[model samples]
Target: MSTAASTEACSTSRRMSIGMLYVDLGIVTRPQLFEALVECARTRCTLPAALASLGYL
Candidate 1:
């Protein structure tokens, strides 16, 4: 893979890791987190922003 592709993959995983951390910590349910992820994709928003919009944070 190219350097840019590798970097993008790493960044995407890090975002997912953060979301999982929140789930594991009981801050949000898996469904809620998945909802936020979907909203984030649709809105092109950050995960934190999506979580906030979903009232998870």
Candidate 2:
């Protein structure tokens, strides 16, 4: 139960939780998630925003 182990365990749990939400709950569709990520990227891009603009981000 060390601090590092606890942090890693929590992260893993959170990842699973998000996966379940995507699959079972349908809180956010796969495409919508992808779009939001792309928008966030465009808002933060400098070297390359092509992925976002091209619908691949």
For model 2, how many clashes? 0
The numbered model that scores best in lDDT is 1
Residue 40 shift from truth in candidate 1, angstroms: 1.0
- Candidate 1 lDDT tens digits, 1-57: 999889767766776899999999999999998998888768867889999998889
lDDT of each: 0.86, 0.50
For all predictions, the C-alpha RMSD in Å is: 2.0, 8.9
Where model 1 places Cα greater than 4 Å from the true spot, the runs are: 1-10
> How many residue pairs clash in all the candidates, one count each?
0, 0
* Alpha-carbon lDDT of model 2: 0.50
Q: Model 2, residue 43: what's the lDDT?
A: 69
10 Cα displacement, candidate 1 (Å): 4.2
lDDT (tens digit, per residue) of candidate 2 on 12-44: 465445544654665555665555444544464
